[model samples]
Target: MSERKQRADATRNREAVLAAADALFARSESPRSVSMDEIAAAAGVGKGTLFRRFGDRTGLIQALYEARVQPLREAVESGPAPLGPSTPPLERVPALLDAMLRFKMDNRHLSMALEEAGSGSPYAAGHYTRWHSDLEEMLRQIPATATTAGFTAHALLAATRADLVEHLLGEQQMTPEQVRQGLAGHIARVLGDHGND
Candidate 1:
């Protein structure tokens, strides 16, 4: 096949793998049990193809997460009010955090699976840096927090980490609304009255 054709085929295969994995994860009560073998079979590709295309289970999970969060990332990057660049820093910070929390809650199983895959510290992930930087910049805009923005941003993001989210919903048996309200209360305390702005 020509190089262009080969590239097109590869893209199609990649999409098929991602789609199959997404479906499997979505359907499974235990996402971690949805193995590479099952994903390969569902995608109509060999197990070898899966390894070759994605390196390993962690890589595949990371890719899926990145793909899933792309929309949220775009919204935060430039989409509109609340999350967009136009919002005031205090309001934007809480909004961004609430959005992240909601994504984790909505994708609880998948998020837990990704975390269990031992992909290493989430701080090392590229997406984490983007979130941290955006949050840190916002925190810096508040004169009272200028000096601690970096630490504060990381701390805030840490609250929404997948494991913690899972623990709250799974172990603590907190309803999603309770979790949201709790986070809002925590954020309000952290940001003072400015958070509701």
Candidate 2:
């Protein structure tokens, strides 16, 4: 094979390994459940190739998380009317939360593991940190404040965590729409705090 062909094969090998890792990790967050050998077998590459590309389990986890979240970020940044850049910033807040909740529901276990992992691993750390930054950016765009807004964006997100949301919608038997409306009311009150009588 030519040098270019060799490079192309390597690229394919790396992509395959990441895809395999994402699937296995999505099912279970146990890094031990997966091994470079299994990943190589799944990818149709040698174990050495998998190691060369990803260094170790941590590197694989980081790549899988990045691959998973990059599309989500892009979807928020430029996919649809509300989520994409089309809607007003204020309108985007509830919509953003709704989208986020849907994502959590879709990838429940992975989401749970990632949340539990916290900043202990990059895979988990990025999502946790990004939430704060995401909240801050949204507040800035809406021109709300941590102080005068009645609650910090971070506070709102913490309240809206999947566990809390499940407690409300699932355990409490509240409808999804009702939860959304409640959240909206909370946000409205917070925003109203800065307004003069």
Candidate 3:
């Protein structure tokens, strides 16, 4: 096959795998219960192909997580308003954090699986660095937070960690809206604002 055809086939196969994995994870009561074998079968690809495409389950989960959140990332990167760069640091900080929390809430099972995979530290993941760096920059723009921006960014992100999200939504039975409101309040307190903004 030509290089172009080869590339096209690879892309198709990759999408198929991701779609299958997404469906399986979404339907399973437990994301971790969805195995590589099952994903391969559902995607109509060989086990070797899955391994070659994603390295391992950890890599697959990571890719899926990234794929799932790409839309949000793009919005924050270049979209408009609350999430876009044009927004003020004071307003944008909480909005950015809220977006992250909402994503965790919406993709709880997948997020949990991704967090529990690999080194068990989502902080070490590639996407985490991008988010942390962006938030750190945003925090730095505020006079009050500029000094402790790095630490503050990490701390705020910790509030949306997968395990905590799971606990808040699962064990604590907090609705997604309630959790978002609580996070907003906490972020406001951290920012020395009343969070009503």
Q: Highest TM-score among the candidates is held by which one? A: 3
Give TM per candidate.
0.87, 0.66, 0.91
Each candidate's lDDT (Cα)? 0.87, 0.66, 0.90
Q: Sort by lDDT, best first: what order?
A: 3, 1, 2
- Between prediction 2 and prediction 3, the one with superior lDDT is 3
**What would the per-residue lDDT of candidate 3 be over residues 112-171, giving only the tens digit for each residue?**
887778765667778889999999999999988888899999999999998899898889
Model 2 RMSD in Å is 4.5
Estimate, for each residue in 40-112, the C-alpha lDDT of model 2 and write its tens digit.
Answer: 7877888777778878666666566666768778877778867777777677766776677666655544455
Residue pairs clashing, model 3: none
The better candidate by TM-score, 1 or 2, is: 1
lDDT of 1 by residue, 1-197 (tens): 89999999889989999999988988887787898999999999999989999999889988888888899999998889899999998789889999999999988767777767764776776667888998999999988778788998987888898889888998999999999899988887877743334
Q: Clash totals for all models, in order?
A: 0, 0, 0
Positional deviation of residue 9's Cα in model 3 after best superposition, in angstroms: 2.8
Stretches of model 3 off by over 4 angstroms after superposition = 2-4, 193-197
Segments in model 1 whose C-alpha atoms lie over 4 Å from true places:
2-5, 27-31, 193-197
